[model samples]
Target: MIDQVRALFAKNTFLPCDVSTIADDADLYDAGLSSFGSVQLMLAIEETFDIELPETLLTRRTFASLENIAEALSGLVSKAA
Candidate 1:
């Protein structure tokens, strides 16, 4: 999931830095992830992970970092399980 997220960031021109080097806990927003880019990422994540994100998780806190993204995904995946 992290790999997919990194790839999404790498492919997005909005991300100002290398995706691979981003720390798992690093804030993507602070690293230059624009608000619109985050929405794009959310869509990518849904497609990649095969999970629909609930509206409750579509907030800054959930997308703040790679770790947060993973946590949000884990919740959704576990719920589906």
Candidate 2:
């Protein structure tokens, strides 16, 4: 899931630095992820994972870092199962 999310970030986000080099828990916003980039990433994640994130989960906190994104996706995937 992390790898998938990482790949999605690489393809979808506007981060200035290499997504792979960012720490899993690092703040993506500080690394150059804009609000629009996060939205694009959210869409990409939904399409890739085949899960829709709840409205409540669509927040900066959920998309704050690679680890957070994976964690949010994990919960959504489990619930979908």
Candidate 3:
């Protein structure tokens, strides 16, 4: 799941640094994730995982880091199952 998230983040988010080099808990916003980029990433993630993230989960905190994104997707994916 993390791998998928990382791939989506790397492809969707226009980060200054390599997503692979960053730690799971690293701040993506600090790495150059703008609001527009966040929305793009969110849409890409939803399509890739076939899960629509609730509006409530669409926040800076939810997309803060790789771990956070994974955590959010984990819950949503489980519920989807």
Q: All candidates' TM-scores?
A: 0.82, 0.90, 0.90
Per-model lDDT:
0.82, 0.86, 0.86
Candidate 1 CA-lDDT value: 0.82
After TM-score superposition, the amount by which residue 62's alpha carbon in candidate 3 deviates from its true location, in angstroms, is 0.3
**Local accuracy of candidate 3 as per-residue lDDT tens digits, 1-81:** 788788886675467678999899999999888898888888888888898899899899999999999999999998999
Residue 55, model 2: Cα distance from true site in angstroms? 0.8
Model 1 residue pairs with clashes: none
lDDT of 2 by residue, 8-72 (tens): 87776468789989999999999999999888888887888888889999999998998999998
The TM-score between candidate 1 and the true structure equals 0.82
- Model 2, CA-based lDDT: 0.86
Clash pairs for candidate 3: none
Model 2 lDDT at residue 52: 82
Q: Considering summed lDDT, which 10 consecutive residues are worst modelled in model 2? A: 8-17
Per residue, candidate 1 scores C-alpha lDDT tens digits across 34-76 of: 8998888888888877888989999999999988887788778
lDDT of 1 at 34: 89
Q: For model 2, name the residue pairs that clash.
A: none
Clashes of each: 0, 0, 0
